[model samples]
Target: MTEKALTIITQREDLPQLFGKRIENQAAIEEIISKIEFESRSITFDIETKDGQATCRSLAAKIASAKSALDKAGKAKKDEYTVTTKLIDADRNLAKSRLQALQDEIRQPLTELEQREAQRKAQHEANLAALGFVNIQAHDHVGSDLVKERIVFLENTVIDDSWEEYKSQALEVKDNALRILRPELERVKKREDEQAELARLRAEQAQREQQEREERIAREATAKAKADAERQAQQIAQESERKEREAKEREARLIAEKESAELRAKQQAEDAAKREREAIEAERLEAERLEAKRQANKKHRDAIFIAAKDDLVAGGVDEEVAKQVIKLIHENKISNVTIKF
Candidate 1:
């Protein structure tokens, strides 16, 4: 025969005791999630598909329905967290506001009463300060111990059963102290004012003297500068006049030299012309004398030649030989000649 198979099943309650509480808590959380999912499914819209193009009205209605569902889901999911947070915060803030209001109601009047008491005390102290109560000593009749007692009483006064009585007593003491010290303070103030006035007058006098001295020095400096400027102007004028005179003299000398040079050049040119003319005249006269002497010599020579020729012919020589001898003499071919008879 085949053996029968046995399977063992473990129940949650039969599991270890330590896991029971955790399992129970997980079950509770799952149940809450299931309920939330059920509600979400109930509100959700199912979109349908059509084969052809959808009509505008149907499409718009579907879009509107989908958007509304999305918005509602988002809001609901947000509220799931925000609702608890808002409740806790509101309860905490409301409790705190109520406690604060109660505290303020109790503290405001007490604070105002304390502030008024402080103001009264400050005024009282200010009155004492005005009288110089702390600075100036009381007279011999009003002892220091009594003054200390009065200050203590004013400081301790409050808005209580005996505030009016203590305040009046303190004011009376302050009045008596002021009455004793006012005359002495006034006398001291008058003496200080007189001394201050005298000092101010002396300072003004010194300042005036210093200002006058500075003005005098400045005037002297200005006068010296003016005098120096005048002297410099005079010197400049003298130098300029000298320069002008020298310039004129140099110009005159240059003009005279130029005229002298021109005159000398003209004389040289005239002398050269005169010398050239004299040389030409002397040359002409020399030529005329040479020509006159040449003509006289030629005439004497011709007469001599004629006389010799006649002697030769008269001596019975051949007429042609005589003529030939005369031609030789005329031509100077014979240096010396004797005619034979």
Candidate 2:
């Protein structure tokens, strides 16, 4: 009987281009396996040859031979898978190393150039700030006629890598600005000083005028007080002279009234004495006249009695009876009777 071989062909299209050669090597191994003589599913050999049936022992021998061929094919496929995976890992590692080296080479010069540019920009800004000319549009005073040309020149200038040119131009503009500002500052100070001096002089003049006005008021008050005192003294002197003249006139009138009263008392005393003397003389004359009348009446009465007595005696014729009738007649015992002889 001719011997037949069992083989398996491995096909893989998913592998990378770098591992495509490994697929050929795997194909050669598959050819070797196909040439091997074994009892398998693809290769057929009869265990019972022209006999009625086969016993269990012959079937066991055929199964053992088929198992050995299957084990060899599985081992070959496992070995191929392991070696191909290792080759792909080595290729990936080589590619990563090459890419890292290329990146380092390209970036080194670019980094150095960037660092230098940053440094130059910082130096330019610092120099402009020191000159006080940064953001020039914000300071309109820099464009004044005093330093306009110099300021405009500095503003238009560009800053290169050389620091010396920028510094020299900025210092020149600063000097020009100071030169213009110094004289104006001095002029303002001089005007303020002159105004202050004028104010002080005016204050002194006002004070002097006020002092003179006060002195004049005081002198006028003193003169008015003296005049009032002199007028009061003259009034007092005139009042005293009037009182003295009134006292002297009253004393003279009292002396004249006293002498007149004494003369009136003497005249009244003389009139009283004359009236007493006249009354005494009239009383003495009345006493003498009454005495003479009493004497004459007595004589007349005696004669009448004697005659009547004689007539009675002659009629009767008795002397004694005649005496008695005469006596009765003298005594006036008989009334309204005449004696007849």
Candidate 3:
């Protein structure tokens, strides 16, 4: 029987869904049992006569189907469609009997699997209970909302009345349990409390750092803006100064040009005046020179005329005047002249 049990255990472990489906079917039967609502005084035979036999038969048929599927899977070779010699090698009745024996053998391992599942659930609850202590300690913290960055930890579930009340009303239970369990529960609770405190402190520090970083960034931006404004102002001032200097230089150039024009005009006027004076002085000097030449020519002509008259008066065709007169008397009865005086 033990050997057979081991064999069925191995088979069920090898094919868990076959057994899992069977268990699910059993749970459905229990659900049906709950729905019937039998009084305590009710007899078993009455229920069995109506629904129990039918349910058992249905279960048997399903079991048979499961066995057939297992047999087929076992007979299947890894690379071929043909059954292996393990089944073909056995007597036909013996193989069928061995397959049938597996159903009865399935009970114990399934119970053990349930037990292990229960233990796993218990451990999970214990861990949750310990974490609940941390949650309770965190109630005192002001900004726990900020600290809880991840998903919310608590969720609700429905159970049987007794278990349901225990979950819904865990506070009274925890307090009582803490009193009895003493140092163990206390230690776990204290550890979680310490962790929550540490998390809170770390969150505060991070907030401070974020604020400081923002302040620094703002200061740098302000400084850069101020510097840019100052540079623009200086540029504007320089441009204005440059324009002013250009205007002043233009003014100076215009003044210089005007002064040069005036000087040139004055020099031309002076030159023209000097030329006119020279022309007038030259005309006067020419008129004086012509008058002096005319006067000297008249004096020379007068002197020549006087000398000619005297010569004519002093001598005619004669050498002596008395002789010339005697000649004249002899020719006519005119008076004679004195001889030589």
* Highest-lDDT candidate: 1
- On TM-score, the candidate that comes out on top is 1
Candidate 3 per-residue lDDT over residues 1-341, each given as its tens digit: 12332244245444423322346447322332332223211323334475866655654554455446555544442323234545565677787788778865877799789999787777657744653453333343324342232113322222234343345455554454444434444454666689889999999999999999999999999999999999999999999999999999999999999999999999999999999998988888888888887777667655654444455456663335544444454456675532121
TM per model?
0.33, 0.22, 0.23
Cand. 1 Cα-lDDT: 0.63
Worst 10 residues of 2 by lDDT: 9-18
> What are the runs in model 1 whose C-alpha is more than 4 Å off?
1-82, 102-115, 125-237, 240-244, 260-341
Q: Once superposed on the true structure, which residue ranges of model 3 sit more than 4 Å away at CA?
A: 1-229, 301-341
* 1 or 2, greater by lDDT: 1
What is the descending TM-score order? 1, 3, 2
Question: Which lDDT tens digits does candidate 1 get at residues 23-138?
Answer: 64574234323543444344423446342234434444544554454445446556666889999999999999999999999899999999998998777566545433544343
lDDT of 2 at 172: 65
**Error of model 2, residue 320, in angstroms:** 8.7
- For model 2, state the Cα shift of residue 20 in Å: 99
- For candidate 3, the per-residue lDDT at 48 reads 48
Query: Which model is ahead, 1 or 3, in terms of lDDT?
Result: 1
